[model samples]
Target chain A: MRERFITLTSPVVPLERDNVDTDQIIPARFLKATSREGFGDKLFHDWRYDSAGCPRPDFVLNDPTHRGTILAAGKNFGCGSSREHAAWAIRGAGFRAVLSPRFADIFRENALNNGLLPVQLPAPFLERVFTVTRERPEAAVTVDLERQEVRFEGETAPFDIPPYRKRCLLQGFDDIDYLLSIRDKIILFEKQHAL
Target chain B: MNTLFDKIWDAHVVEALPGDTHVLYIDRQYIHEVTSPQAFEGLRRRGVPLFRPGQVTAIPDHNIPTLCQHLPVADPLSRAQLDTLERNCVAHDISLFRIGTPHHGIVHVAGPESGLTLPGMTIVCGDSHTSTHGALGCVAFGIGTSEVEMALATQCILQPKPRPARVRVEGRLPAGTCAKDLILHVISRIGTAGGTGYFVEFAGTAIRALSLEARMTVCNMSIEMGARGGMIAPDDATFDYLRDRPFAPRGAAWERAIERWRALPSDDDARFDAEFTFDAGEIAPMITYGTNPATGIPVTATIPPAADPQALAYMGLHAGEPLVGKRVDHVFVGSCTNGRLEDLRAFASLVKGKRRAPGVTAWIVPGSQEVERRAIAEGVRDTLEAAGFVLRQPGCSACLAMNEDKVPPGKYCVATSNRNFEGRQGPGARTFLAGPLVAAAAAVTGEIRDPRELM
Candidate 1:
């Protein structure tokens, strides 16, 4: 997996819902897979499909007008059940980042670990994003991790990204990778503490 | 800086190598059948034997059918997973609690009842609800599948220290309220992501009034708030709960254990990274509206307007809708959250001589064989049967959709399970979370009604 803190390019599909839980994001039936592959198609499977396996035209993502590589959701996105598959599906579906007003704690961590950037913006900022995305269908939003800013078409706003997570994303480091980097220090400390 | 999480992490951190991470030694490891099979396979492939067999305990729960102890597991994959767990445990000489074994139950429930979980120890499990053990004043959290393998092979994991957030519950709980209600209120108020990146410590007067089982209910939902885990200072309640448990100390040993536990409370002036306080009396019987547990309101309250477009669009709920009379097609009372003996007793008392709604299907399941046996002995099973409710055996029966007890797509269920996340009961199944009493009332009314009406 590419670890660099690269810029996201997906069009922003805004979902203004609180408590967007993991099961809704990716259903349990999809969890049976042993490998993490092919989850992209199953992301939001129920919402995207109807009883006959036909695409639901009424769904937001299915709307041809709102096509983007990024998903800008509402407050408390990715709430409920600590399923990492939700993040995996979002990432596999070719989306690199998710911008939201608020993110569920476990879901945020899962997204970050799987290299999916979860951007938390204020409610007002989120509203502004939805307005802009709605008004200008072709609007492109750029999320710069290095600068900690979200720049829309001709407008820019600064957002908060925790310093630790920022460092990890910028360095393309996961929990294990970050820990392994300090292996020598840990070994030394263990040696010194040996009694 | 001196939070329980920091204390535990610092004590266990043997080294900090080149990267911003620490190599930590694990004190205890708990595993269940659902997540351990793949981890064991990984270990086998790597030729890694368990480092400390005694520190690990294995149990089968998630896939075990509730109603039939002898019914061959209908799902081939679930049966294979259980068989794999038993085979692995036997081959590795690890303690395995198979079906019908006295020790077989949800791993979280089994751990505390067995006295294997004690104060001041760090515990790790493969399930997110492992936070349930934090009620014993230990730092416990869930690990991923790969991490489970690492723990089995080396009994250690690399982890970053987490910050602490203290949640204090003061005032006396009103009649009809419980720890389940308190947690639901707290999560709803904070939203689901409120506890992210923090170890929560629950305190104050109202919390003290809760039984250890109730306290476990509160701590079990810590992960729902995005918290790493939750802890409550050990006290008389804690000691009392542990005293008569199967694995607890006896005679002089019991007194010594209590003495040690007494010192496990936090210092009076101890500082926390963050603090939040809520009044217990202000809480009411809470129920979820949208898929997530945090989108909850008092049983009598109307569903809040989906002010946020995303929330409204996703939940498919209109503004100003009275949640009270929302139609429910099913009622589920089971899971580690509310599948205990007390939970069944509460449901049974409410359902006795009361016929369930003709259109509603209610499945009441016990968390373990012990809980089932105790409930049967107390006549709760008979009461449920007479009331037209189906009492299933011990397993995580509809709290999740893993077993055959799933709600049909597009149906609404009032559940006693911890999470009401979208599709938790089944694909496209709408779940409204409530306490057992409230769930019983819903079963009888065929709608989201308050338990107080039944009383």
Candidate 2:
């Protein structure tokens, strides 16, 4: 399973809010589905629509201008409730990376394990991306997992990514994958302990 | 240094594998309906019966409705999941406490209360709030579904031992401040995620002064700080709480267990990877402004400026905005965190005569049927109902927005739950995390307020 990691190809959409919790990312009503599909359609189900099921045109994602494979959000994204489904919906929705100032620890772990890149960019950098995404509808953003840098069209600075998480994402490695990489060591230790 | 983490880590390590992880045997495995479904499926696929069925205990809490015991589950998926758990437990010969059973409650609440949690045990559940059991001086943490399967198969997990932190709270907690407030204050001071990759040992006078129920509340939020777990040394209070618990030993066995528990405290000179101290009196009733638990201040104070560049940019809140008197559309007072009988008594004490603010929807859900029964017997439920609040059946209602209970979008809710992260109550619903009393006060005023004045 240790193979070349696939780079994210979907366009990024920016949701500029801090403390975006699991419930908001995917409401409880959506959890009724056992399969992890159909979640993409319900991402931000209540926020993007009104009570009558009409789109809330005022929301950023509801606006046509901000469409992309990456979502550049405000700091502390995925802040409340440790539901892995939040990460599932984000990944299932075809988003490659979620850029924020920080993330709730559980959400970060969930995102990484589920093959979603939750990038921790500085506040100014995140703000710049948000502005650029809002300003240029066609602008493309690139996140190089190998280099651990995020680059956007006409952007002057490259944001930093934690080296360890970057390595995992770049290799498409989850905790189990990382552990399995050293299977021989585990066998050896098990043998020694058994004796 | 021989910190609690090192001692526990050393004791539990079956062997150190080459991948910077240690193979540690889990002493106790707690299962709930939500996460156990996939794990049971994995077991079926692997053709593995539970390796040590006796070590596992399953409970149906999150998805089961509280009040309707004999009625079918309202949600099809929740019912299927609960049914799957019941079937799986029976197939594997593992113990289960189905809803309406005396042992049933939120798994975290039920585990320690039933004496399934004890000092020196390594406990893991598929739910994040599993850290609540750390209050029993154990190494408890949450695991994913896949990891849960691995534990059921081998009764062992590959884990990287965490560094240890000793958080000491000294001085008397002023009247009306509680263990919930103390933990929230600790999160605020240290910042959420400060204890990441660390096991926390909560000590000092303030922690000792708290009851076992209160200590569970503090440890329950340890996960919010990204810690593996939190613990307090076992004392008389711990023994007393465990004395006649269903699963606890009785007669001479109880005395023997107490003898062992008494020696579970860390040595006076024991060192920690990190240490922090706080004056309990300095903490007041706290409420979260931003999406994270750490973004908190006294209810009387204004929301602090999102001065932390990251916090400000994310929260969209200007500094010095008063959190007090901010209008709230809903008030939710339940969760594994603070949905106990004691919490209800506190909330009822504040809302006894006053009516729930007009136009505000308040949900009062007990953590368990036992809690519900206790509250009803104590007249707490009557007081709440008389005040126009609806007492909902048990389960983790509106805490994670998993069940039918949820706040409408853009509405503000004062919640006694552990988290105030953005949209915790519902989509775009702002949640102000507070204690039960503060939630009661908010229910009355229809805004964030201190319960002291209301009483």
Badly placed stretches (over 4 Å) of model 1 are: A1-16, A63-69, A119-195, B1-6, B15-24, B33-53, B83-94, B149-154, B158-160, B244-259, B304-327
Residue A52 of model 1 has an lDDT of 78
Residue A111 miss distance in model 1 (angstroms): 3.2
Location of the lowest summed lDDT over 10 successive residues in candidate 1 chain A: A174-183
| Candidate 1 C-alpha lDDT tens digits along B1-455 | 25555665666776554434455777789887766766687677666678679778888887777767877888887877778788888998888777887767787777886787877778988778888988887888887565677678766675556677899999998877777899999988876678876889999999888888788889998988878889888887787777777766689877776776666666677788889999998999888776567777899987676644444444566768877887889999978788788888888888888999989988888877788778888888899989998778777778877878899877888888887765678866778888988898888888878888787
Best by lDDT: 1
Candidate 2 local lDDT, B1-455, one digit each (tens):
35555665576676675544576767899998776776677567656667679889998777666456688887778877778888989999999987877777788877887888877678888777888887877788887565677678777776656778889999999888777889989999887668766789999999998888889899999877767678888788877777787787789877776776676678778878889999998999888777678877888987665545544444445678877778888888888899888888888889888988988888888887678777888888889889887777777878877666878877888888887755566656678888988998989988877878877
In terms of DockQ, the best-performing candidate is: 1
Model 1: how far residue B443 lies from native, Å: 2.8
Clashing pairs in 2: A10-A69, A11-A68, A11-A69, A12-A68, A12-A69, A12-A70, A18-B314, B66-B394, B291-B421, B305-B319
- Scored against the native two-chain complex, candidate 1 gets a DockQ of 0.27
Stretches off by above 4 angstroms in model 2 are: A1-18, A46-77, A95-103, A117-195, B17-19, B250-260, B305-329, B353-360, B377-392, B409-412, B444-448
- After aligning candidate 2 to the native by TM-score, how far in Å is the CA of B274 from where it should be? 3.3
